[model samples]
Target: MTMESATDAAPLRTQTVAVKSSFYLAMRILEPARRDAMYAIYAFCRAVDDIADDEGDRAQRREALDQWRYDLDELYAGRIRPRSAFLAGPVRRFGLDRADFEAIIDGMAMDVEEDICAPDWEKLELYCDRVASAVGRLSVRAFGLVDDGAKELPTAPKLLAYHLGRALQLTNILRDLDEDAARGRLYLPREALEEAGVSNHAPHAVLANPALDQVCAPVMSRAREHFEQADLVMAGLSKNAVKAPYLMAAGYRSILDGLTARGFAPPRAPVRMSRRKLVGALLRHAFL
Candidate 1:
């Protein structure tokens, strides 16, 4: 549904408060309009991710995800409900399209299958497309680039969105390796690791082996490719459009740098960019 359909709905103060408190600091780097839009987008994503990662019986989690998908379908059909009382404004303000939100649902649904594998390259790409690329699409909308009237390559924004998504997804895979392993989730493909003489079956063996560096090198290299693509995508956007993504890219790249410094070892804690660094990047982008 378009932005015009929900102009009359009551303001989403409670929802906005939660989203702003949670995501607003980083989002504040964005153009005011885009920042407002991003609150909606992030809230929607955070909600879905919480369902997938939160404590619950596997079946219960799956049911919640399924219900989320149904809510997504209804939202698209203009039957919007205040699920969290925080989503209405940003969703309406940004005029986010239904498909972008649904793609998130599709990605979360993958978690319910209970068989996390080291996906082949093709499968991994598809997974990234849904989970990460979809987020990028939503970001494009937040950046107010929907229906960009271009004479050629109308998909530049979409490509940028996908690249951003892929880069972040890769960062997550690396950062969560230890935790994911304990939970029986392996994101790095078995074939690639095996080719480098690493074993997914014995994750600790691979971690202990010096050859694990070899295994991570290719994955990091590919992640860099996507990162470069995302950079190119940013180059084609308005300066305002580039700000939030630039910070996000820099944050992800910092994690990559940290991984490289650790000889590509998995992180013991969540990899995060300092607030100072994040704000510094935005200030540079804003004034430069």
Candidate 2:
């Protein structure tokens, strides 16, 4: 695949911010070239994820994911012609790992292949590892954690990336519980739900249960542990490299905190931080 300079990567930049302006804001800590690369990677991930989350036919979604898998194979095989313009630039420029990308795709395939309902805690962790941690591994490369612009990561920051990914992803899950329920998916483990007096595993039943925090307590606890571990692991990163991760963690933590403030029950309306609050959190993380 050929390299496209940051200026030529406008398509990727637009796609990424369109999906997640919050992430784009956090990513501003990086230099322009690195920021462009980060945008490209996020766009790639967003594309495959759209397949998994699409409301259209499942078969067509699977086909789309498969096409990307084929394209990724071409990416690693030095076949320049078939690669996507947005993905090819960053993957080539950053020397992103084939394994990380494949792991992410595998995670998307799991959603297509299996019905994610009433999973065990272990199963959920496996899903998180495949989807979130793998993305983290790839993202840190764009954040300048990799030396010489190579695919491999040193042990410490790599570990931190994985844990931070888990933390952020769990926060997402918590925030989206109602939304996911509407789509007929429930990520809270069956055992935990049962323990909290949630006898019926139906999405509506679980959604109506008054003891949501009790049911989701374990997962929230686990998310906090990962964030703590991320803190410990992130100590190894250089000052500049730590900024983006810090901003991410702090921002997401506030969201998690908001969830807690609401008694961990997802409200009828979606929760969001105001721009003023987000800016405040960003400043604290970036400076303090």
Candidate 3:
């Protein structure tokens, strides 16, 4: 299919949804081709995520996810369907890993299979890797860190993906505690819950527990460490190479800082970067 068809295949609705996302600035700042590729990836992610979170029947959701996997298989086998045609160019041009795409599907499957609550640290990290770092792995290629047709990614980009992905995901977990609890989901590790003497894993009960802040302390600390590691990795890369990811890290770190300042106590106000702060981050990363 022609690039025009591929571009058109990326639904306008998905682009609109992506434009309203927190990573809008990060994706927007890329060069045209790279930005398009990133948007395609984001659209793919958003579609599957919606299915995973849908209140529909589990079997239908699983069937939907399976259809995506079939489409991916088609895309890889040089048979592009209208639904996934947009990804063909990026996948070929950037040498995007098929497994990374499948990992994302698998990650969504985790949610479909069960609502995760207080998983152990290893399981939590695996969840983070599948859902977040796998996306980062795909993104680093689109960002031009790994050359086209490269056999494998370099150590630094890989590490950057590993650290930044987990950093961002953990921050999300901390920031969305109340929202997730409202949906009967809790992402805090079981070890942390136990360490904090939180016995109940019921989402609302856990949220109402006075020791929630204690349970969150280790998670916050871990997120900070991952952000620090991401910073260290970014410092070693070319400034031009890391501009988008740097902005993402900066934006998310600001949110994490806001969360820390807001504290995990009851009545936690929703934390977000103001438009002015977002503009400041854009200017700083874009031109400075």
Q: Quote model 3's TM-score.
A: 0.95
- What are the models' TM-scores? 0.83, 0.90, 0.95
Residues 207-241 of candidate 3: C-alpha lDDT, one tens digit per residue: 88999989999999999999999999988888777
Stretches of candidate 1 off by over 4 Å are 1-25, 148-153, 200-205, 265-271, 274-276
Model 1 poorest ten-residue lDDT run: 6-15
The candidate that wins on lDDT is: 3
Clashing pairs in 1: 15-85, 15-86
For candidate 2, the 10 contiguous residues with the lowest summed lDDT are 1-10
Q: What TM-score would you give candidate 2 relative to the actual structure?
A: 0.90
217-266 per-residue lDDT for model 1 (tens digits):
77888889989998887887787667777888877787787777766544
Better of 1 and 3 by lDDT: 3
Which window of 10 residues has the lowest lDDT sum in candidate 3?
2-11
Could you tell me the lDDT of residue 88 within candidate 1? Answer: 48
Kindly report which residue stretches of model 2 are placed more than 4 angstroms away from their true locations once superposed: 1-7, 10-19, 81-83, 149-151, 264-267, 274-277, 285-288
lDDT of 2 at 70: 85
